[model samples]
Target: MSVAHLIGKAGKPYTVEVEKCHIRQFAQAIGDTNPLYSDEEFAKKTVHGGIIAPPTFPIAMSEESDEDLDLGLEYSRMLHGEQRFIYTRPIRPGDVLTCQLKVTDVYEREGKNGTMEFIVMDTEMTDAAGAHVVTSRTNIIYRSVSANA
Candidate 1:
């Protein structure tokens, strides 16, 4: 069966409160030594007014779940193709955000080996006031069984 029917399928939305520690840890893990993500005093001196998360901090804030939408993909044949994030404003500690993922597109393409299926989705994040914050688009590539042979 094709995954075309899941184009608009969305998962359960979950809330997460951005925290100082998590942001700081994520920065450190990614080898980012920017003071804006660690030093509150330094961050206070900057335009952001306080410590702010790094551009990729939302990845740490999001949770993976199969609550509602399931692609029914073969785990062994799946490969992460691409990921891009769009942000309206910088994320700071104490900000509460709700995130939900929905399938946007599903298509098949002829690869060098054989046919590959691409699943595209977007994870949208919104603040407590229902303002859009960030949108993370992810693409997953699945190798068809015939391609393996």
Candidate 2:
């Protein structure tokens, strides 16, 4: 989306039921050996009282619907620049989480090869009870590459 139109746009929400299996897979993929992420019984005894996803678990949440921003940039040109997450509560299994994504910032810079466009998006996540759970900000950079190159 164009920065002029996207800035201050309310986040469009995407909801999903956090599954135990998904959490296990994500933890395993990240090489996290924390018992709370994989062992249900172990997690049950912890303070959380149940299996909870990792702090970076939001990365596993797929887009709920096609609300993709039409940035007029090629997919091949995109690169993940940075990510940060702030959590108010741990994500436990069976929690129906809703994350709303909104364009936060857009800017341009000159990279080693060419001009690069940066798009920053923030995802605000909440539990089914509407309690704030996590806020994640991701920056994606798009490199301008000529067709000849």
Candidate 3:
């Protein structure tokens, strides 16, 4: 099955409630000790006015079920190629975000080892007030098994 036909396919929307503890944990796990991510008092003095999640914290927000939209790539041959995020505003504790994933583009290219299929997707995160918060673009590459072997 050609996954090229799956472009524009979107998965079910999921919501994630931002929590102070989760934000702090993610910051700590990433070796970041920024006050904005942990100290409410310190953050209160900042423009954000409260604790906010780190920039990369949205990486932790995801839908567990990708079964809704399958690309039909060999699981073992798939690799994460790249990821980029565009944020409208910083994520803050107590914010409820709705996220939806869609396949934006699909293409193929010849690589050093073989022909690889690149699957590009965009996940848009919107706040409870129906405002865009961030959009994360993910590129997934699948190398041809026959060419590699």
| Best model number under TM-score | 1
- Candidate 3 global CA lDDT score: 0.83
What's the TM-score of every candidate structure? 0.90, 0.80, 0.89
Ten-residue stretch with the least lDDT total in model 2: 1-10
> Against the hidden true structure, what lDDT does model 2 obtain?
0.78
lDDT of 2 by residue, 37-91 (tens): 8887898899988788888888766355347655455778678999988889888
**Candidate topping lDDT:** 1
Give a tens-digit lDDT track for model 3, residues 34-105. Answer: 898888899999998888888877778754334556666678877889988899998888889999889999
The superposed Cα distance between candidate 2 and the true structure at residue 30, in angstroms, equals 3.0
Q: Model 2 residue 143 lDDT?
A: 64
Candidate 1 Cα errors over 4 Å, as ranges: 64-68
- For every candidate structure, what is the RMSD over all alpha carbons to the true structure, in angstroms? 1.8, 2.9, 1.9
What is residue 118's positional error in candidate 3, in angstroms?
0.7
**Rank ordering of all candidates by TM-score, starting from the highest:** 1, 3, 2
